[model samples]
Target: MSSSIDSQTAAQLQEILVGADDAVEFLSGLAGMAAAAVSEAAGDTIECAITLKLHRRPVTAAGSSARAIELDHVEQALGDGPCIMALREMSTVLVVDVSLDARWPLYMQKLLDVNIHSTLGVPLEISGGAGAALNFFATRPDAFSPDVYEKAEAFAAAASNTLQLSVRLRTVQGRADDLEAALESRTAINLACGVIMAQNRCSQEEAMAILTKVSGNRNRKLRDVAKELIEQLSGSPVRTHFDT
Candidate 1:
């Protein structure tokens, strides 16, 4: 189905994608916008929550509201729900009425207890073995009419590209952070080795050996030991050029 997102909504989603500080923030904004759009289209109050499963990472969830977040957590904690099923199956899962749905008894009961009588789960198309879904909750039974389903599906489709871009940006940022940390660690070790060489009148290799021995004896990370040794000499923590 074609995306139901209007040009204005598309612009808003793009704004969230570029303006958000990270993937989590982007997902939160997406959930809020999705909830608002779906609620308007359906002419009913609908709450949204997004579930994300990235490679080698624990599943994460974001919601449009506190109650929506709490409900998503309830599904995550129980380990079974329309949203989970949708993610697992990579298809839409609709519970027209929590009272009639028998697929997830425990989860449905939990939703019923909280007066959420209907739910719709739409899988998002994400690349690189990552999985995601947009989940909607409503208080009345059969809240997800055919038109609502179309709108939800369209929103999910339109969101998939931006979400993929956000995930890639997050991955790149993580790599940059790791590289910066490694550079800082290497700088500290080099500076400490210089100090040791100057004080002990030894070669660079001997100074490095001494530092390694101290690190092993102290049972600390090599970087931590190097940082501590440098701090002792300067009376402050080591700062590399990157720190500025």
Candidate 2:
């Protein structure tokens, strides 16, 4: 297959990235699209699953269907399979016939039990110490011919940049959420401290010390204790501008 992505598939991948609400949704869409692409190329039904790893640990998995998801999970649970191997080796791993592939005995048995006889695992290039792969499953032996393999590899290559963008967006969103939560917690704690100072006729530092003591005695997080105190005093839940 050519290294360059065809225009239509590239547009579809771009659409998946732009329209997805989060990383999970984006991965699911990507899996479905990958399945469709390979199926179209091979003229057979193929299921796809995507596995993502960060720091050499599995971060998430998505599938084109429920069965695809289950198969991927089985591989993860067993800790060995073509997909896992592909991610680890950063190369394509193909099992032309699951029954005959003795490399992953347990995984082959599991796939045979599910009536899936062939599989292809193609790694996606991603930066930031992140790794990803597209896993394709078929119901017949040697379903992934050379042409099909080439097509799948091409699709994975084309989708790599989009996957990287999705991951970066998710990381940014997570950091923003953490920062927002910290700000809200600080606001609640300050308000709670003010209430304590007024009620006890104490200094701000004294109020903070009292609050900390109460938090430790209750064995609860400082933020939780602060929020509860404010809620009890106001007879309503605390609401920050970030709420809703």
Candidate 3:
């Protein structure tokens, strides 16, 4: 039986590796793939959550909808859970048969209250830094046997790759957004410069200086000042230059 299980786990790990390439439509979808793998392996309802501290704000990604949301709230409000422990320890923590396990009295009780009888969660980390936890929860007491743990570790490895990719993708997306914002600001400042040049009959550089002077004096943003100028030209005091 053990040998068969190992063979099954190996096959599943291979499938995960194949399915998890670089073609992720969204971060949530990657997490869903993980939860689905665990469910198929454990033959029960499984939930997985990935939590990371990005830019000093805690961001959570979950594969199962309800369990993920519940866990998110629990971590935010209580600040203590398996996910936190996983990130803190940077190691896998499996609590098989939670009803019988006495570790973490408060959280364990909370799990029982939610009808989660067994759990096997492993911390998902990136390069020794705190990343996220690949958490699996089930409704059966003996859901996580040794075989399950071995299979889960293999699954976690695949999920960890997805997690790392998601992180890099997000970083790239964020930088792209910043670059777009900077370009927009530059365009707005230039538009305002043109408006000032036309209104004051000054050179382009002189108009920019006026804008700077006015912005500094009023402690307002250059774009805001430019927006106000355009609105003034339009003869609409209530008109806003920017959407915000």
Model 3: clashing residue pairs? none
Task: List residue ranges in candidate 1 displaced over 4 A.
Answer: 1-7, 21-24, 54-60, 242-244
Q: How many clashes show up in model 1?
A: 0
Candidates sorted by TM-score, best first: 1, 2, 3
Query: What CA root-mean-square deviation does each model show from the true structure?
Result: 2.8, 3.2, 6.7
Each model's TM-score? 0.85, 0.80, 0.71
lDDT of 3 by residue, 1-244 (tens): 2566545544554454446554333445545656776677677767766666555445565455677657655664566666666667777777777778877777788888888887766766564243666667787887777766766776666556655655676578789778767766776678789888888899999999999999999999987787787667766532324444
Q: Write the per-residue lDDT of candidate 2 for residues 110-130, one digit (tens) a residue.
A: 999999999999999998788
Candidate no. 2 TM-score: 0.80
Cα error, residue 100 of model 2, in Å, equals 4.8
Q: What is the lDDT of residue 50 in candidate 3?
A: 60
lDDT of each: 0.87, 0.90, 0.68
| Candidates 1 and 2, the one with greater TM-score | 1
| Candidate topping lDDT | 2
